[model samples]
Target: MDAIFIQILNGLDKGGAYALIALGLTLVFGTLGVVNFAHGALFMLGAFCAVTTQKLLTISKHVQDTSITFFDAYKDQPYLEIWWGDFGRTIIDWSVPLSILLTIPAMLLIGLSMERGLIRHFYKRSHAEQILMTFGLAIVLQEIIRSIFGANPIPTPAPDIIAGSAPIGALFGLDEALVYPWWRLIYLLFSIITVSGVFAFLQLTTFGMVVRAGMHDRETVGLLGINVERRFTVVFGLAAVVTGLAGAMYAPILSPDYHMGMDFLVLSFIVVVVGGMGSLRGAVAAGFLLGLLQSFASMNEVKTIIPGIDQIIIYLVAVVIILVRPRGLMGRKGVMED
Candidate 1:
């Protein structure tokens, strides 16, 4: 029972990431009608934002260790530690969260630039062209990141205060052995809040209503004098910010690497498709569903019986879902119909 519960938590943790990424992808597709392969690059960039924040905070001077008389050894002592002492150290420790401030503006600008300078040009083009162009852009972004940050994965850890496991079992009156990581729980909550916020903004606000209308009939919204194209440009930027926050928060879970974005890109795309091309609710639902299935499939008992089911469960489920319901579990009719 404890093991099962643990897997459930694990599933939710993974699902949060999948759902966040898929949500942003769906937003861009629904609003701009553009298939953006570079969305993952934005995620990678966000993770790097956290990395850069840590680096900047820890800018250090080499200090000679006089105790090591045999060989001259120099320790890198951070400027923060030297300047403000413990307070500076605390700031350094909170670099991942602090980077959120930097990520918002940076990602927004990047999204706007991509849309205004490049994506806008291809709005009327074929899906294949968009895919090729965006894929090329993704590669270019990847290479640039690699050149700057190198090829290795950089570790970004959660703050010490919440780095340990939580006694979730006690809260639920279950076995105390059923503890979960504090950061994972925080991430799950974060995902829920972000998803809810997006939904609320879209459903309750005038700007969101116009954007929603634009998604249905862009020409009609234009005729209504709403500047639908401009609204969509902002939508693209919002998507970037959402994806960026996901990546920034996720840095502690998965080490930030130049290729990490590409790694999640394919799975996220599958998630978007399985959820329904333009359905936000479907995307969120499918993400958690697949995440749970993947976690359960990874259990020793299941893997022993099926041998490598864990590795293929998601794809297999996707195939089945596509075959069974062409429009997906929650997709509307004629979403992708020609």
Candidate 2:
């Protein structure tokens, strides 16, 4: 029972990331009608945002160790620590969370630039063209990142306070063995809040209403003097911000690397397909569903029965779901029909 519960937590942790990324992808598609293959690059950039923040905070000067007479060695003394003492160290410790501020503006600008400078040109183009162009853009972004950060994975850790595991089993009155990382739990909560905020913004705001209306009939909305295109540009930026946050938050869980975005991109696309082409709710649901399934498939017992099931479970489920429901789990009737 403890093992099962632990896996459930694991599933939710993975699901939160999948759902967040898929939600952003779905948003861009639904709003802009453009297949944004570069969305994952935005995520990768976000992780780097955290990395950059940490680096900037810990900019250090090397001090020679006089005690090492046999060999010359230098130790890094961070500027923050040297200047502000414990306070600066605290700021450095909190780099991951603090990076959110940088990630937001950085991602927003990048998204807007991508939309206004490039994506706007492809609005009426075929999906194949959009895919090709965006995929090319993604590669370009990846190369740029690789050139700057190199090919190695950079570790970005959580704050010291929540870096350890939580006694979840004790809290829930379950077996003492059922502990989970605090960062993962925080990430799950963050995902829930972010998803809800997006939904509420769309469902409650006038802008969101118009955006939804535009998604349904863009021409009619444009005919109404609504400037749906501009709104869509903003929507693209919002999607980027959302995806960036996901990547930034996930950096501690997985090391950040130039290729990490591409890794998640394929699975996220699969998630979007399983959820439905432009269905927000479907994307979220399918993300969590696949995450849960993948988690269970990774169990030793399950792997014993079906070797390497964990690696293939998500794809297998996607195929089965595609075969069963051509439109997807919650796809609208007319989507991709033409």
Candidate 3:
């Protein structure tokens, strides 16, 4: 029972990230009528932001023990360390958390630029073309990131206070049975809050209403005298920010690497599909549901029957759901077509 709960928790976190990424994808697809293959790359960019900030924090102008022959050979001074001073110390200490703020505007700009410069060209093209071009864009983005950040996984440490495991067993009246990591718990709460906030914004705001209106009928919205293009652009940017934020928060748990975006991309696509494409509520439901399902798949007994169940659970669920309901749990037909 205890083991089962642990797996469920694990799945939820993974699923949460998947769901968030997928939600963004679905929003753009349903609203803008473009298949955004670069969504994953945007997510990758977000992780890179965290990694970049982390790197910036630790880099220094002060040379490390130059007594080492390696430093002598490289002749590299830790110039940034000296250049940054206490500012660097503060950054090193708080960059991971602070990165969320920095990545938002950056991601938004990238999202808008990509939409206007790259994706906008394909808006009038067939779905197949959109997929191909966007997929190509994703590849390009990955290559660019790899070229810049290298192909290594950069370690992203959680803030000091949230670094270790916390005892939750006592709260459950079972000592020594239910410990959880503070970071994991914080992430879970963060996911819930973000998901809720997004849903609320869509449900409550007139601007969100305009975006939703544009999604359903871009022509109609345009005819209604609203600038559909501007709204869609913002929506595209919003989608990027949503996925980027998820990626940023996720960096600590999963080491941020150039390929991490590609790694999570498939699962997120599956989650979006399962959640019914454009349904906001469905996306939230499916994200948590899939996360829980993934968690359970990793349990000892479950894995005993099928080793590495976690690896296949998501694809399996996607297959099963698609076969059962081609449109998804709450999908609306033609939402992806403008």
Error of 1 at 263 (Å): 1.3
Q: Give TM-scores for every candidate, taking all chains together and pairing residue i with residue i.
A: 0.96, 0.96, 0.90
| lDDT for each candidate structure | 0.91, 0.92, 0.80
lDDT of 2 by residue, 88-167 (tens): 99999999999999999999999999999999999899999999999999999999999998999999999999999999
Looking at candidate 2, what is the lDDT of residue 199?
98
Worst lDDT run of 10 residues, candidate 1, spans 329-338
Question: What C-alpha lDDT, on a 0 to 100 scale, does residue 329 get in candidate 2?
Answer: 89
Residue pairs whose backbone atoms clash in candidate 2: none
Candidate 3 segments whose C-alpha is farther than 4 A from its true place: 63-90, 333-338
Candidates ranked by lDDT? 2, 1, 3
1 versus 3: better lDDT goes to: 1
Task: Please give, for residues 1-338, the per-residue lDDT of candidate 3 as tens digits.
Answer: 66666677777766677778888998888887787777888989998888887776666543446567654433434444467766655557677788887889989999999888988788889989999998888999999999998898888888776787877767666657688888887787787788878778777999889887876777888998998888788889988988998888888888878877776777778888888877776777788888888778767677899999878887898888888776778787754322
TM-score of 1: 0.96
